[model samples]
Target: MNNWELLEIRESLLRDLAEFIEDNYYGTPAPHEYRRHELDVRLGKKLKFSSSYPQMTIRQRRASDLLLQVGLCGATEYALGTIEDEDQLKHGRERLVKMKGDLADLMRDYDNCLSEEERKLLLRQAKNNSNREESLKDSERDSLLKLVIGMAVGAYCYNPAALKNDAVSDITKDLEELGISISDDTVRKYLIQAAAKFPQARKA
Candidate 1:
């Protein structure tokens, strides 16, 4: 059959499957015996059916789960001419390929559907949002740096050996206690910056 004919058939099958799930699972209750028999006939299996509500729900959910895979395989087969790939066709790789192709098609359609002015407006809004977020991050980083420098200066005033290894270890622990974790190396760097900023504090 032609690809168009195959797609049409698959669409009809999906519609019928959806209707079956809705009616039997979501519609008014049917006789358990009848439902069980119907399921057996449709599935071509002679398995037992449980009368409990939970068991019925499980079966219905299983039926619904098949809908997506069936649709994916149908679309993949139609687009790729066949669903038979030796290396890339097993274990849902084919579905992933189909999903990526569908996403590309959707993006293309979205671009085609929007006007040039609308696209430009969206781009401007995205850029503005990104810049605002970057500005906020810079402000936060500056505040944190100032706080660290002040702490480093205070430690230097309290102890003349503030930039030494033991002093840096103590500063690192203090920063951790204040919920600001800094490595010993970073603490030493901040201490050096603080000493440069406050030469009098280092001399005193």
Candidate 2:
């Protein structure tokens, strides 16, 4: 019920609503629901975890997609993917400059009114916007995307032509031996998604 706790709760509820909206509105129905169900099941497991963070992240008592002008910049950062190299970075900076300026302008209305804690939060946020943090975000995003895509790749190897069932199992075994934390089910889901994207299968 403290301000910090309240803020975290609000953010979590907003995220869940956003997830629902994206699945219901933007994503394909059957597949999207499948993903949503998967998320829910994973979340159900998380409920038994003895952590406040998990509770704060999902299954809230109320929905709260009522954020103001400051939208999902973090999620946007997630979805926009990432730009590699200084040249791409510089171009992105140029494009974001105008938007950042606009944000600063909006913040001015509450400038003198901001709490000390809020001000420090803003300062850290500014530091985080520097390339180092952006790179960190990109690295994190890449890890998750790779998991999604890699799972698909592992799934494809499940039924490779000329390979016996035991041999195919060994192929997935090799992938695990290589140190990737993926499940056979995740791999199967990824393969289906990959197939949906390509017009025709290409020899690898």
Question: Which 10-residue window in model 1 sums to the lowest lDDT?
Answer: 44-53
**Every candidate's CA RMSD:** 21.8, 15.4
The sequence of per-residue lDDT tens digits that candidate 2 reaches over residues 1-204 is 122333343344345445333344323222222233344333433333435444443233223212222233222222222454667667666655655455445435434444578667755545554434347565665565555445444554433232122322344455656664443334444444544444244336
Global Cα lDDT for candidate 1: 0.44
**Residue-level lDDT for 192 in candidate 1:** 61
Each prediction's whole-model lDDT (CA):
0.44, 0.40
Instruction: State, as a TM-score between 0 and 1, how close model 2 is to the true structure.
Output: 0.25
TM-score of 1: 0.24
What would the TM-scores of all predictions be?
0.24, 0.25
User: Which window of 10 residues has the lowest lDDT sum in candidate 2?
Assistant: 61-70
